[model samples]
Structures are given as structure tokens and as C-alpha cells.
Target: MKKQELIHLHGLLAQVQNHYEEETGNDVEHDEYASVSVRPTSIHMSKDDHKDAVFALAAGITSELADEATEQVPAAAD
Candidate 1:
């Protein structure tokens, strides 16, 4: 992919991650009724797995971008 396209994709991925974080954030101020509660532990592969997947995907994309950038750079002669 072109540099510009890679940059745009990276930006888009960042936005998506930011939005997901916001959505999953604990907006205490927005809560009308606040109460102390303990988080439940479950054997579900939904939340953490999903975030891990996104991070893995982003890392892969970033690696690809770096590879592309290096390919575009001319190697120096010894």
C-alpha cells in the first residue's frame, strides 16, 4: 500500500480504538445512580479477546507499514 493510504488506515484504526475505549469507559459522571459494585469474573472470550484482537491487528498493520517504508528507502552501498 501507498504511504498516504497506510497513514490514513493508521489514523482510522486509532479513531476506532479511541471510540471503543470511550464506549467501554466508566463514565461515573454520566451515571444517575452510583453504587459500589464488584466486577464479576466469567469465562467469556468477548471483551478482552476482542481488544487483544484489535491490538494484534493494529500491530500487524504497523509492522507492514514499517516494512513498506523500509522498502521505499534506497539501500546505501558499502
Candidate 2:
């Protein structure tokens, strides 16, 4: 992946993480997944690993955020 694309994906992941924290009024603790932690800033990886990591992070983040958003919505009953 290109440098700019990596940067953009990193930004999106970070933004989603931050949004989740702000919405729930808590700081996200990313103590696990050391690779993920260093991802946004620097991901010491090969080209394939870099692409895989970014996609994995994006998928995970999107799923978590979607779950949170779903919980916040009100359901209607007939």
C-alpha cells in the first residue's frame, strides 16, 4: 500500500476509536494488540502485512463501532 493510503486508513481507525470513547465517556484501553497500537503511527511490516493489518483493524473497528451505534438506537414496536 502507498504511504498516503496507509495514513488515511490509520486516521479512519483512530477516528472511530476516539468517537467510541467520546460517546461512552471513557478512554479506550488498547493495551493488547501491540501491532494495532503502533499501526496508526508506524507499522513495521512488509507490504502484504501492512495491507492485511490495515484491513483487519478497519474491519474490527467498524464492527465494534456499528455494534455500539446499534445499541444507541431505539427500536419500534407494532
Candidate 3:
């Protein structure tokens, strides 16, 4: 993906994190992403940097959500 696309994805993920936290009253521990020090608006940063940040952010968000999904929910017709 292009750098612009990656940046856009990063922004979207950030929004997702915010929404999840606000709704669940839990925080997404994105220490790795924080350590990367790259935000979606950090357009001055390199594409690789944004890529790394995106990976870290995605991993953190997914990992947290996965933990919450440990219990299987029954599949039922609505």
C-alpha cells in the first residue's frame, strides 16, 4: 500500500481504538505503538515508520479484543 493509504489506515485504527475504549471503558495497551512515536499525522515520517506503527497499533488492538473473545458466544438467529 502507498504511504498515504497506510497513514489513512493508521488514522482509522486510532479512531477504532478510541471508540473501543470509550464503549468498553477499557484502554488498548499500545505501548509498542507509542514507543514508535509515529502518529497518522506524522506525515514527515518515513513510510516504513508509519508501517511499523500501523503493525504495532493493529497488534495491540487485536490482541486486546482477542482476549475478550476467549468465551465463545452461541450462534443464534436474531
Q: Candidate 1, residues 30-62: lDDT per residue as tens digits?
A: 121112111112223344433443445466445
TM-score of the candidate numbered 2?
0.52
Candidate 3 ranges with C-alpha deviation above 4 Å: 71-78
- What lDDT score is found at residue 15 in candidate 1? 63
Candidate that would win on lDDT: 3
Q: What lDDT is obtained when candidate 3 is compared to the true structure?
A: 0.95
Better of 1 and 3 by lDDT: 3
lDDT tens digits, residues 1-78, model 2?
686677667667778877877888755445443454446656555445556556666666666666667885577998
Candidate 2's C-alpha runs over 4 A off are 26-38, 72-78
lDDT of each residue in 1-78, candidate 3, tens digit only: 999999999999999999999999989997899999999999999999999999999999999999889968889998
Task: Quote the lDDT for 77 in model 2.
Answer: 95
Lowest-scoring 10 consecutive residues by lDDT in candidate 2?
28-37
Superposed model 1: Cα runs more than 4 Å off:
1-45, 73-78
Candidate 3 TM-score, C-alpha based: 0.88
Arrange candidates, best lDDT first.
3, 2, 1
Candidate 3 pairs with clashing backbones = none
